[model samples]
Target: MQSIVLLLWLALCAEQDVRERQIANTLTLGVGLCALIFLFVTGHTWIGSDAEEAGWALAFVILLTIPGYMLGQFGAGDVKLLAALALATDRQYLLGTIIGSGVALVLWLLSRRWLWSLLSQKVKNRLKAWGDESSKKQPFAPFLLAGFLLASVWIH
Candidate 1:
């Protein structure tokens, strides 16, 4: 059930990133609600080892990452997404999330041109319509998702 929720969250993030280039507030709220529901259903024991420490973990993650956001490295959506994920995970996994997302962004930046060339013209045009003027700055959702998965598996 936790895995299912994670997958759903990742899918929604990816979809929103591609089409809207932003994660709607409602989407983040929905993800948080789902996490809360899952916690409620499972007696809050299934999601993470230390549910009590999540708040601190969240603050820690935010403090470490918010600087990047404020510096215009990404956007508020990404920060909010990370916070939501922090709620769903423990400290180690949260660290994994940060590292994984960062690595994903770097890799995407390095391979963007080749990846863009691989996209079909129609897809490119659609992406461009979503305000992708330079075809750079690819969405971070997919990379974040990948990072989340990797962190979940390898970090703990």
Candidate 2:
């Protein structure tokens, strides 16, 4: 049930990002908070205090976000989504998700660049140098959803 909601949240976040290149802070905060509370209520804590665990998850999300934000690859929402996932999964599943999302992110970036290289020479060169920061219609939520699912399947 939690996983399903997490997947749905990621899907919604992805759709919003693909459509608008932005995600509301309320949504991310709500999910992160809820997950933390749920974990605590369920007596399945991560490490330290819940607040500390949430902070750690947020840090992990920020770490993943740096590259994407630096290369103009993704938005803060993506980072928040990953952060929420990190909180939900906690330390136990963190390793799997990191591996899963990392793999997906690499593949996604490579493919996006490969397609960009097929554009005009000038555009291709520019893309090869700095990459496109343009907003477009691509559903990336599915990839994230897949990553979470795959990690859950393999790790658990």
Candidate 3:
């Protein structure tokens, strides 16, 4: 049940970002807060085991990821989503998620550039309107979702 919701949330976030180049804070915050509330009331998350010092864990994660956010390496949405996942899982799972996301991002960047280079001018022009610039920005939510799901599966 929780996995289904998480997958849906990831999909929604990715779709919003790809379509609008923006992510909503409401979604991230709402998920995080709900998880926090669930933890407080039930002593366990919807997905993972009972959190030990969950507040400290959340704070640590936010602090740890903030530098990347500040450097524009990722959006605030990524940070919030990770923190929320931390609430849903444990530190070990979060590490796996980060690693998986990083690998996917690197591969995506390489493949996208290579594919763009192979496209014809007409195709490139059409794709450009869809915001496909080989050297331009790319969305991270999909990669994050991939990593999150992969990590969740592997960790469990």
Predicted model with the maximum TM-score = 3
TM-score of 2: 0.60
How close to the true structure is residue 11 of candidate 2, measured as C-alpha lDDT?
A: 74
Question: Candidate 3: where are CA atoms >4 Å away?
Answer: 113-131, 134-136
Worst 10 residues of 3 by lDDT: 126-135
Worst 10 residues of 2 by lDDT: 126-135
Q: Against the true structure, what is each candidate's TM-score? A: 0.78, 0.60, 0.79
Ranking by lDDT: 3, 1, 2
* Residue-wise C-alpha lDDT for candidate 2, range 52-136, written one tens digit per residue: 5655666777776779877877666666767777777664455566677668867877787676656898655533323445635
What residue pairs are clashing in model 3? none
Return the candidate ranking by TM-score, descending.
3, 1, 2
Is 1 or 2 the stronger prediction by lDDT?
1
How well does model 1 score by local distance difference test? 0.72
Reference-based lDDT, each prediction = 0.72, 0.64, 0.76
Q: What is the lDDT of residue 61 in candidate 1?
A: 68
Candidate 3 per-residue C-alpha lDDT over 53-149 given as tens digits, one digit per residue, 9 for 90 to 100: 4665577678878998888876777788778878876666667777888888787767876767788998776446334665355677777788878
Residue-level lDDT for 154 in candidate 1: 86
